[model samples]
Target: MLTWAGLLTVLAVLTGCTGSTPLFGDNRSPGDAIRIFPEDGAENVGADSRIEVTVPDGRLERVKVTRMEDAEHGQVPGRIAEDGRSWAPDKGARRLGLAGKYSVEVVAVDGGGRRSARNTSFTTLVPADRFIGYFKPENRSTVGTGMIVSFDFNRPVRNRAAVEKAIRITTDPAVEVAGHWFGDERLDFRPARYWEPGTEVTVDVGLRDVEGAPGVYGSQRKKFTFRVGRSQTSLVDARAHTMQVRRDGELVSTVPITAGAAKTTTYNGKMVVSELHEVTRMDGRTVGFGGEYDIKDVPHAVRLTKSGTFLHGNYWESPDTFGSDNTSHGCIGLRDVKGGSSDTPAGWFFERTLVGDVVEVVNSADKTVAPDNGLGGWNLGWSRWKAGSALR
Candidate 1:
């Protein structure tokens, strides 16, 4: 005696009354609904990964991620998106260690004050032993200075061949790049010498999910391009009392320079332009070379070492003494026309040179500067530099 429309209306009212009931008839409590974007059982999350979640007909109240143990309780530092509908952690947190299963959960509340949750689990891919090393400068776009491509491994590498094979470097003009390990976790890539001026350089990193060591894996494939600028070199021989400035291997100037005294001979071996200064104070005690009468204001100084070495304007030294004497403490003294003008040999070199220009210091008695000191790691021999790696 019931009409079809009337019966359907009654059924709809009954369904609304049973709000927040389980979508699947497991007969369990109408608990939180768990919806995983990229789905509940997704595989192959890329290196640059961001996870997304949604709650059907509900607003998310809170979300948390936890290890399978569930004891840690979703507290690994994730970021909620501005829209308040999504969350992700920085690359450092997202890099998963070991091939294993992981879990994510979200909680939301519906219009009827009914709560729901959705849970998802995914298995991460087993990382390969071999991975490609990405090469590129960190931030700066045009490679004007000492910009070398380097990588910071999420895990310490145990097999050098595995990582080395993954790293490949090439240039438009066929410039070569060599890899040198600064330590267990850092690797730098550069040519045997400064890059050819105006050469186009590209570095490719295909090392996603590659096992770096026990319980660690890489999470990225990186690619970047940089343009090499002018080729320039500055040779400073402490004993010669001269700095030969060259552009693209051609001599440009032979400026007389005063070297460090006998007790403080300039450091021998290759160095790079780490920084430049218009006018800076040179404190004697700061470098541990101060005597009772040492002056604090050694002006117009350009620092070359953390140990207080400089190429500065010398007010104390006469012009005749520049090319003839190695007096005072450890510093490269050049004749300047006061006010730190760029026309002086010291200023000209400083203006033309960038932070990564090669400065060859020869004919000194001191040991070679450590490659790890500053960005001078490029000075290490290829075989010797490779030996420092845990993977090698």
Candidate 2:
């Protein structure tokens, strides 16, 4: 009952224009040839979500998955399957980064020589629990030759191997660096011997979404670099009350000092200066000695041990007390003024020291400092140090 004009209008609306896309846009018979996982506009995707791009009957030309807002760790690495139709991520990148946004761009060529491209985005779910690592030597810092890379985690790690593997260390003018685990919470890395002067070290941490324990995920993904400055170490003779400073194997200064009294002897062994303070409070009560002494202002304090040992300035003692006799409570003291001065022995040494500089104590009654106390890994032999690695 319809006329030719009316019929033509209905046919045009139904099939669209000749050889052109339909009204709803590219409504091809097979739709788009390219297929992307974690489809566009997805939110709260699981960390273990499958991520890939595929074409039903085509060869993938390009596939790039990038993490949003992290330029340092920009892309998620993957490879096209042998069949040339699919792509998958590497084993290390299987798990998506928790609380991270990702963008996927893909390109493929179909059997008919037609090309297709797609761009999609997704956001991963926030974790219920996350573990982070606190690392040492600081980024882009210049430390002494004895500097060691250390990490202290807030929570205990049950999967030590996985966590260790996540940390990648590389050096310029490369040397062999090994990692050692101190129980479950601390990890340290060092070369066989002290690092050569001017050596550049880079640490790449890719622990994001790694399961450190049951249901506990790691959340740090970053890179850090540091350079080794000149080598400076000091030797403290507790029995003789003298400290010898050395730089690059050259004897620089030999200054008078006072070691721990006989009853409270200083620890003997290699120690690293982990902290430096111009002035700090030293209370005997804090270190298990009650009513002995509490100094409100101890100057030029260089921390040597976790058990309250320091090589600091001493103004309260008699001027002659330094070279005469050892009289202190488990500390090495150098004669100094009430307020620290640059001309003083303690001040001169502090100025030349770096955080990673070594301070070794000899001829003391106390046993060698434990390898775990401060950065005392130098106390361990090369073989023993390597054996402590989880990888070993």
Best by lDDT: 2
Residue-by-residue lDDT tens digits, candidate 1, 129-191: 533232224322455434566664534676555665576667889965667776666677766
lDDT scores of the candidates, listed in order: 0.55, 0.74
Candidate 2: where are CA atoms >4 Å away?
1-128
lDDT of 1: 0.55
Q: After superposition, how far is residue 353 of candidate 1 from its true place, in Å?
A: 0.6
lDDT score at residue 312, model 1, on the 0-100 scale:
69
Which digits, one per residue and each the tens of the lDDT, describe model 2 over residues 1-392? 11111111100000000000111111121355667778776767998889878887969877889775232335888999988899989878757776666877676767876555555567777546987676776777788888878887767999999999999999987999988899999999999998999999999998889999999999888988889999998999988788888889988778888887877778899998876767654545445554466553566778776556788877777666666678877788876665576677777777888888899999989889888777889999889999989888
TM-scores, one per candidate: 0.54, 0.68
Q: What number of backbone clashes does candidate 1 have, counting pairs of residues 3 or more apart or in separate chains?
A: 11
- Model 1 Cα RMSD, 1 decimal: 25.2
